[model samples]
Target: MKLTLERSALLTGLSHVQSVVERRNTIPILSNVLMGADGGRLTLVATDLDIEVSESVDASVDAPGQVTAPAHTLYDIVRKLPDGAQVQLTINDDDRLDIDAGPAHFTLPLLPSGDFPKMTADGFTHDFTLPASELSRLIDKTRFAISTEETRYYLNGIYLHSKDGLLRAVATDGHRLALAEQTLPAGSDGMPGVIIPRKTIAELRKLIDGTNADVSVAVSESKIRFTTGTVVLTSKLIDGTFPDYERVIPRTNTKELVLDNKVFASAVDRVQTISAEKSRSVKLSLTDSNLALSVNNPESGQAREDLPVNYDDEALEIGFNAKYLLDVAGQIEGQDATFMLESASSPALVTDSDDDQALFVLMPLRV
Candidate 1:
């Protein structure tokens, strides 16, 4: 293939594609990006078996053909070129892709384009469009709570589905759960709940970070695809069932405490300074109107901080992971963070004082 593309355009498209190609791969073709020049645009594609991304950039096409080259190496060459310089790419008969800018030159060995794997778009049953901002909010709010444990694969992704005109995203890692909801972007009445893998969530987030325009999504039985004008990403969904997360959320915890979120988070941060790295345990001593945050480490030291709150229930003391508590507190957007409790040993329901759309739950730790 032969084409001349703007340096910035090539860099942007390469950044999206090369990120999908892992730094190391067993299959040589999987380590390379497929580039095609046709219809006055250059198409770049990359994949790592389960997920694939493709992007097209406007170019001055002098010839029409396709070739594969090392994704990262090509990206690096273009990225280091002078700003606004046009980059010329050509595939010679010797199977080397030559890259040229104003005064710099580089060549990358090419693999046959036929060896590149392409994900099919068959069996797509659902298609929809959503605003970039709303979709990002849903991901950002729940992705933090996703599990990193490999054995429990179901918790490794954000669960997305639509019901009763509401689209919800939920994630949990056994220790804590996060749920966020928004109005359904389009028809998804019969769409099955999908457990999107952690890698796919991360890739989608990067794809949407550059544009504010509306994007389209298509879902098949075992795959999902997102597309903007120039970028397209297709990923395989996790082949597992997510647990009945609703059962994990406590619905009857009646003890309520509301405190300024900024104050609560800051106090917890101060108290956790003395916590041991392994346990990270913190105790919350609660009374009519005061909450005390404290941590003790036998090998080091102890810390305690008190904050005022609005609570008139029976006094209680609860033990929780300091990191978990702070994570939940950071998600609270209102002036006050609300906690609903059953006892010192039960899980705590966390949310904003008035908003009900997003919820967080934290499991208690034994002191």
Candidate 2:
């Protein structure tokens, strides 16, 4: 392959596909990016067996062919090259990729592109389009709670489903859960519930421009595809059933405490400094309209702070992971974050005072 690409254009394509390349790979081609140049365009593809990200950019195609090269190394070289420099890439006779830009030159070992695995995406049952910002809201609101434990593979991704004319996403990690809902457009009425893997959620989130562009989505039983402009993401769905997250959402919590979102988050952040490294526990003591936040660690020290809230309910005390509380508070869009508590042992439900589309549930920790 022989082609020349504007530095910005080449960098754009490489940036979109880098996350799909795993840093450690057992297979050779899986670690390299496949580059194809033809018809005045260059396409870059990176895959980690389960997920694949591809981007095509306009370029000067001297000769139409394909080659595979180290994704990160090539990206780093282009990143360091001077601005506006034209990048020339060619496949050498010795099966290496020659990169030349400005005064710097580097050769990366080339692997056969045919060996790169592609996810099978056939028989798409539902196809629809969502505004970029809306899709981003759905993913961002819930991704923080996605389980990182490999033993519970089913909980490692967000559950996406269409219900009651809304597209809902729910993610949970046993300790905390986040649920977000967005209006569903036409043709997405009968979409099946699918578990989008953690890596795909992250890659797709990166593609969202949060602008006027609309993202095209196609969902099949085994795979899901998201395309925005020249970038495409294909991922295999986790073949497992997501737990009934709705059951975990409490409906009978009557106690309410409303406080400034930023104040609560800041207080949590400050008090957690003295929390134990192992538990990271923070105690919440609610009395009348005053809320006290405190953390004690034998090895470290003790931290305490107080903030007046809108609560007038029965005085209650609860314990929670200081970091998890901050994460939930950070997602609140409005000025006030309201928490509905049932008791000291039960989970506390959190929601923005004005935003009804997002909700969070936090299980209390024993201090």
Candidate 3:
């Protein structure tokens, strides 16, 4: 392929696709990016077998063709080039890829384009459009709770489904759970629940970051595709089934405690300084209208902080992981955070006072 484009345009396209390419590969072709120049555009594609990201940019096509070249090496070269410099790429007779820009030239080994694997997405049962803001909110609120434990592969990503006329995203790691919802878009009725893998969720998140354009999503039993503008991302869905997360959400807890989210998170952070590094436990003692946060570690020291709250329930004391508590608190956009507690052993339900669509549940620790 022979094409000329601005350094910025090429860099943008490379940055989007190169991230999916792994640093080490067993298959030689998998290490290269497929580049095609035709119809006044240059398309870049990179994949790691499970996920693929591609984008097209305007280019001056002198000779229309296709070739495969090292993804990381090509990206680095184009990224360090002077701004506004014109980048020219061509395929040599010896089956090598040539790069030229502003007095610098490099030759990279080329591989056959036919060897690149593409994730086939044939039977998409559901398709929908979601506003960029809503998509971002759904992901940002729940991703932190996604499980990193590979053994429970089903919990390693976000669970997306439609229920009660709301499009919801749920994630959990057994210790903490996060759920966020938005009004169901028009085309998402009767969509089957799907588990989006953690890597795919991260790539989709980065693709939609800082953009106001709507995202076009297509879902199948085994694959999902997302398109925004000229960029398209295709990923294989997790084959394992996600557990029923709704069963874990509290329903009968009536002990209501409302307090400033920032204040509570700060207190947890401060008291946890004297907590054991292994458990990082923080204790919350609640009375009629007061709350006390304390931590004790024989190896370190003891710390406590008192704050005023709006609680009228019977006295209760619970211990929770300080980091998990802070994580849930950070997701609360409202000024006040509401906690529904039943007993010291039962899980505590947390919610944002201003956002009824989001919910959080935290399993208490024995401190």
Candidate 4:
């Protein structure tokens, strides 16, 4: 294929697609990116079997054709080229690609375009649209709780579902759980719930960076796809069923405390410094109007912090992994957070005082 594209345009598209390509591959073609030139535009595609990303950019087409070239090498060459220079790429009869930009030139071996695997758009059962910012917020808040354990394969993804006309994303790693909900869009009714794999969520998050445009989502039993202006990401869905997260959320807590989110988060970080090396546990001693956080380690000294709170319950002491509590606190958006506690052993529910859309549950860690 022969085409002339601006350095900035080509580099942007390459940066997005090359991240999906692996450095080492058993199949040579899988290590390369498929470049198709037609209709005065250049489309780049890369896949690692589980996930695929495609992006198109404007280019001056001299001879419309297609070819596969080393993804990382081509990206590096274009990245090192002079800014604002025009890039010309052409495939010669010797199965090599010649790249010319200003005073620099390079040649790389090419693979047949036919060898690249094609992703099929099939069996999509539901579709929805949402602003990129809101979608990014949902993913960011809950992704930390997604499990990395492979044995429980189903918990390795965020569970997207519709409940009471609300669209929610829930994730849990057995120790901590995050649940974020937003008002469902008009056309999101009857959408089938699916577990979106962690890789797909991460790649989609990168593609939506600094973009305010609307993103279209399509999902089926087997796969899911997210599409924006000129970029599309498709991936295979996890087959196992996610556990019933609703059952774990506490509903009968009798004690409540409201504290500044940032202050509480900082206190947790400080107290955890003296916590046991492996357990990372911190003890919370709550009084009628005071909250004290303390940690003691055999090898290290002890730390304690007291903060005034708005609680009137009887004095209670609870122990939890300070790291898990800090992670949940970071997800709160507003200044104040509400914590509802039923007992020292039961799960505690935490949420922003002004917003009920997002909630977190943390299981107590034995100290």
Candidate 5:
């Protein structure tokens, strides 16, 4: 294959696809990106067995052929080239890929394009389009609660499903849960709940960052695909069933405490400085309109901060992991965050005062 494209265009395409290729792989072809030059565009594809990313960039095509080269190396070379430089790629008869830009030249060993694995993308049961801003809100509000424990693979991703005229995204790591909802997009009716893996969520977030275009999504029992602009990302869905998350969301918590989200997060962060490294626990002693945030660590000293909040119910004291509290607080877009509590032991429900579409639940820890 032979093609000439602007360095900036090539670098953008490479950055979109090359991230899917693992740095080290047992299969040599899996470490390389497949480049196909045809129809006045160069198509780049990279995959790591479970996920595949592809994009097409406008190029001056001199020859129609395909080849594979080290994804990261090619990206680095193009990224380091001078601004506005033209990049030329050619596959030599000796099966090497040559990259030329201005006064700089580099060659990468090639693998047969046929050896590159392409994910089977057929058999999508549902397809829909979501505005970029709404998609970002759903992901940003809940991804923090996604689990890292490998044994519970289902919790490692955000659970997406359509319910009660709303498309909801839910994520939980056993200690806390985050839920965000938006109006269900067209063509999403009767869609089965699917767990989107953490890596795919991260990559999709990068793909949609700063763009205002709508994202086209296709979902099936085993796979999901997201298309935005010229880039297409296909990933395998987590096959395990997500737990019944609705049961854990508290409905009977009557005690209400409203505090400024930023102020509360700052207080929690300060008190956590003296908390034990392992537990990182912070206690909340709530009485009427006064709230006390404290941390007692034997290895270190104790810290206590008082904040005036809107609370009129019976006094309640609860303990939570400082990091978890800050995470939930960070997601709140409003000035005030409302926390509904049933008791010191029951999970606390946190909601953003400005947004009714999102909610959070945090389990208390013994302090």
Candidate 6:
């Protein structure tokens, strides 16, 4: 295979695909990127068995052929080449690749293109389109709550469901849950709920962040595909059922408190400084129009802060992880956040005063 591509264009395409390639792999071919040159363009493809990414860039093709080369090494060589310089790539003796720029040249071993695994586009049931900004917002708000526990494999991905004409993404890690919704596209009906793995979501986020175009999504029982412009990504979905999250959200709670989001978040961050290392719990004492946050640790110290709130409920004191509270507060886009509680032992429902599409449920801790 022989091709000539601009230094910046080649580097940009390599940067995107190299991230999908694992740093270490048992199979040697899995560590190299498959390069295909045809139709005056060069396509770079990489995969790690679970996720696959492909990107194409305009290049001057001297011959139509394909080859596999080390992903990271090729990326590093092109990255150090002089800016705007044209790059020449050639495969000689069917086993080595020669790279040449203005004054620098390098040769590297190549693997047969036939050894690269083929990712088939089969059995995709549903297809839809969503704005890049909207998708990014949904991922940014809920990705923090994704569970990392290996035993609970079902909770490691964000659950995407389409019901009642609204699309929702839900994620949780046993201690806190985040649920966000956006209107479904025109033809997104009958789309099955699927759990997208954490790695896939992260890769999709990076791809979306680089462009403003709309992203097309295709889903099936086994895999999920994302395509935008000249880039495409396919990932294997986690084959497990997500927990029924709706049942966990509290439906009825009489006591309520409304506090400024910024003020509440700042207070919790400060009070947590003295919280115990094992259980980062902070106590919230509520009375008529006043709220107090305090944390006492035997090994460390104690901290207390007061804030004015709009609550007239009976006196209540609750304990919660300071980090969890801060995460929920940061999700509140509005100036004020509303918290409904039944008692110190029950879960708290948090929502913004202006938005009803997103909600957070936080489990309280025993101090």
The prediction achieving the highest TM-score against the true structure is 5
TM-score of 2: 0.96
Error of 4 at 292 (Å): 1.2
Query: In order, what lDDT does every prediction score?
Result: 0.90, 0.91, 0.93, 0.91, 0.95, 0.92
Model 1 scores what on Cα lDDT?
0.90
TM agreement with the true structure for every prediction: 0.97, 0.96, 0.98, 0.97, 0.99, 0.96
Per-residue CA lDDT of model 1 for 153-188, tens digit only, reads: 988999998867898999999999999998887666
For candidate 5, give the lDDT: 0.95
lDDT (Cα, tens digit) per residue for candidate 6, span 1-367: 8899999999989988999988989999999999999999999999998999999999999998999999999999999999999999998875699999988999999888999997887899999999898888788778889999989999999999897889899999989999999899866778889999999999899989956799999989989999998989999999999998988899998899999999999999999998987789999999999999999898888899999999998999999999889888888889999999999899999998777889999999987
Q: Where's the lowest-lDDT run of ten residues in candidate 4? A: 185-194
Per lDDT, the best of the predicted structures is: 5
**lDDT score, candidate 1, position 45:** 94
lDDT of 5 by residue, 1-367 (tens): 7889999999999999998888989898999999999999999999988899999999999999999999999999898999999999998878899889989999889988888888999999999999888999999999999999999998999999999999999999999999999999999988999999999999999999999999999999999999999999999999999999999999999999999999999999999999998889999999989999999888899999999999998888899999999999999999999999999899999999999999999999987
Instruction: Indicate the residue-level lDDT of 113 in model 2.
Output: 80
Superior candidate under TM-score, 1 versus 3: 3
Task: Report the CA-based lDDT of candidate 2 relative to the real structure.
Answer: 0.91
| Model 1 segments more than 4 A misplaced | none
lDDT of 1 at 111: 86
RMSD of 4: 1.3
**Worst-scoring 10-residue span by lDDT in model 1:** 183-192
Model 2: residues with Cα > 4 Å off, grouped in runs: 209-211
Q: Alpha carbon lDDT of residue 155, candidate 3?
A: 94
